[model samples]
Target: MKLVVRVKLLPTPVQAAALEATLHACNQAATWAAGVAFEENARRPLELRKHAYAEVRVRWGLGAQAAQHAIKKSCDAYTTLKANLRNGRYGRPGTKRHARASGKPVVFRPEAAQPYDDRMLSWQHQARTVSIWTTAGRLKGVRFTGQAEQVEVLAAHRQGESDLVCQGGKWFLIATCEIPEGDLNTHPDGFLGVDLGIVNIAATSDGARHCGRRINRKREQDRKLRSKLQKKNTKSAKRRAKKYAGKEARRAKDINHKISKRIVAEAERTGRGIALETLTGIRERARLRKPQRTTLHSWPFAQLGSFIAYKAKRAGVPVVYVDPAYTSQECSKCHHIARGNRPAQAVFSCRVCGFVEHADHNASHNIAHRGWYVWVCGAQSTAPGLTLIA
Candidate 1:
């Protein structure tokens, strides 16, 4: 499997200034390219071409490389936005609006270079070493190997939509790696089912539950801080606002990482397949629950699933996502469906069969059973009677 690990990049003051300068140039280029595209579309209404990079370079007085980078990035954004619109993923064309000054104005990607070679990127450097290059007498840090004191480059790639690096910044990267398919008949004896809930971070099939205590605490603290900041209309409040935003994001991500790691470790120990409910429309559904909206919004279900999937792939275990419709309401023992099956948030009781278990455990059992059924049928079988009783 192709895996990516991110590390930080530590550069000298001069190098930092150069990088910042490059970023500024890139941003200017983006602005220029956007303006050019807008003007061109208004005047002639033709498809924008890649040759605009040269025009931008000459018009903006930017270096050829910097101008090319900026135009390339801007073109990518335009293409993405256009595709999203065409696919009905967003609103109507020309109606879509973006703040002129908002969003990541500049992005850097060394991987976009043609002729992919592992040694060319900074991510390939050895420990305590860095690759540097000069364009127009300005030095830029390429990539660094090994752990640095303050910063590290976790991973870099050309195919990624955005350039991602791990530093004391407000961004994180999640990568998907493909591994060789495992033998289905050699399924693990144990199964782990994970249920994503608002109250609890995750409820697993193995009788282990991870509550959203830290996330709740962080959310409460952030709410209070935001309220206090709103009360004041000063520069300090604005500064505090930015810091709090970063803190809240970090807190959420940290909680997610911990929960995902714990789940992966648990599954790995048992060498079992991990099952999770397909939560595609959860956010939309949760929005209707006004009372539990905050908790629901804080649940990182997608992140947790992504973590479990990548971890499972690395461990040579299978991860399956089953339909979530009645996993919570159905009885694992008798396959009976009733509201009484879930008497409380944590308790599960079957009215028809008198089979009782933890609510999460019951759901997990259903998930595992569903995965097993899928495996045996050699397809995604949705028949309810296919569930096995244990």
Candidate 2:
């Protein structure tokens, strides 16, 4: 698996100008290439590889791979459109399938971004400066600073292609590196299951809980503040709102980091795999009322899941996601699926078996049981078999 780490770059005035110009050139060419691909149905990246790698490099003053990245940008867009069309995500342009149903040709508006292969971007450990290719046809050195830990990682174990971006008078490097996948090693006893929710944040089958009360209150306060500021409609007010929005996200992320750490630690200590629900399409299918929908839309369930996953991987604690279709509604004990199983928000009582427990906690047990079945009965039927649903 690959994960990205963003590092801020400090470029000199002249270098910054060159990088900006290069970004613009690359994006313009990408946009043009995208239009050509869409019109001609050139889906593969290599379809235009010859012309893009040969001609666009000279025309746009881009490095070899940088120009290729632009071609990738265009072809990727065409590919996405094609997928949407085939999957009925977006029907033909004339139909009312696409979310943006202008019925016009999909024009590619390539962002002012350039991708850099390892050849185009190099790091000097001694000087603590990174070298990148620019439109000026010169190799420029940009300092990568901030976050000591991130800098250390950039200085060591850097891998794969990276993106050089210019925004708000600053340059940033989105560096990518491979991470070791977790080798599933379930405990002799069983795996642990965790259920994620809005009210509790996360509930474990082991009966531990991480409450979301404080975070929800803080988020509501920030939301009210932002709404009030947006009503003012002034530049400063908007800026302040945006600033606080970032702060609030950071606050939430910090809390998620802590929660993930604790959860992974528990799994590590127990030598058990962790089970989670595959909540795909949750946003579209939650079926909540207007206010509830808003809360659900803004919830940080996905972020927390990712945090748990990455931390689990590093700790060698296998993590997996099981089918989430009825984890909540189904009775954890008897496996009976019904609306009557859960008559209240926090309670889960089985009408048939008369088994009762905390809703989320019971859900966690069911998730853990499903994961255990999948792991023990599947063809592979071992520790590693549970990686996808531990």
Candidate 3:
């Protein structure tokens, strides 16, 4: 498995200015290359490089590799534009988008992203520092922080490229790390079914509920704060809104990580496969009332599902996806599906068999049962204790 792990870079004031200048210079070179490529109809990297190389190096004072990076960036954009034109999605002769603007970034790609060969980038485990290549010069020691476990992975399997990114007054390094596909191990005796809900976050067949009250509270607070800030429309308010937005995103991501860790830990403890409902086209297919619509739109179902999958894979837990259709409305007790079975958001009562349960819990049971149907047909688990579960 290859993971793009984020490492927060702490640069000195002088180093920070240098990095900012290098970034802007690289982006400007890339942008200029894009313009020249369009004007000359340069369709290939080599062609764009030939056209832009002299100007980029002379004007931006970018190193050789940096010049190549900018040209490649421009070539990529032109290639994408040509592809879209060929597919008739955006650009075509005499169409509204025929003269499409190439919105190229001012950052170097390919070469700007340092490869983890000894020359351009290096890692110092003891000092927790990193080396990065910049157009200005090579920065020898940039302090950084990341999840310890992921950093340990970096020590073993750090790949060849990492991108330098700046956001909210901080620099970040996103390094690619690779792990073997066959390294994962799994025990498939039983399975745990997870039902995802906006209000509940997640409810498992094992009777575990990861509540969403606190998450909802934080989201509501942020929403109100942002609304007020936007209304004020002042410099301070704009700054505060931007800061709050980033903080809220981190908080949500942290919650997803924690919740996924717990879910995977449980699956590992029980030696059971993890099961989740497939979320394909869910937002488009489902019709809901106004309040339910708000909750569904705000919910981070896709992010949470992705977190569960990657963490489960890392932990050697088998993950299965089941169809989400009618999982909530189906009664686990009687195998009956009806809209009336769930009278309220959190309350589920079977109309046919008079079976009642917490709505999310019941849905989780249904999902688990459905997933077992998938597992039994395809799974090779022949353990003595392997039994059907609902």
For this target, which candidate reaches the highest lDDT against the unseen true structure?
A: 3
lDDT of 2 by residue, 1-390 (tens): 555677778888887777777778888888767656656666578887754566777777677677788898777766677677777776655565664632333453334557888778888766768888877876556777767766665556568777777655668888776556666554525778889888898999899988887878878888899889989999999788756657776777778878888888888888877887777788887887776675688877788788787777766676667888889989987899999899999999999999999999999999889878766764122122111110
Which candidate, 1 or 3, has the higher TM-score?
3
lDDT of 3 by residue, 142-237 (tens): 898877876787778777766677877788777777765433444477788999887899999999999998888778878789889999999999
**Model 2, position 286: C-alpha lDDT score:** 81
Question: Which ranges of candidate 1 are over 4 A from the true structure?
Answer: 1-4, 41-51, 59-65, 87-89, 92-124, 132-186, 287-289, 379-390
lDDT of 3 at 240: 84
Winner by lDDT between candidate 3 and candidate 1: 3
Single out the weakest 10-residue window by summed lDDT for candidate 2: 381-390
Query: What C-alpha lDDT values do all the predictions have?
Result: 0.58, 0.74, 0.76
- By the TM-score metric, which is better: model 1 or model 2? 2
Per-residue lDDT, model 1, residue 36, is 63
Q: Sorted by TM-score, highest first, which candidate order results?
A: 3, 2, 1
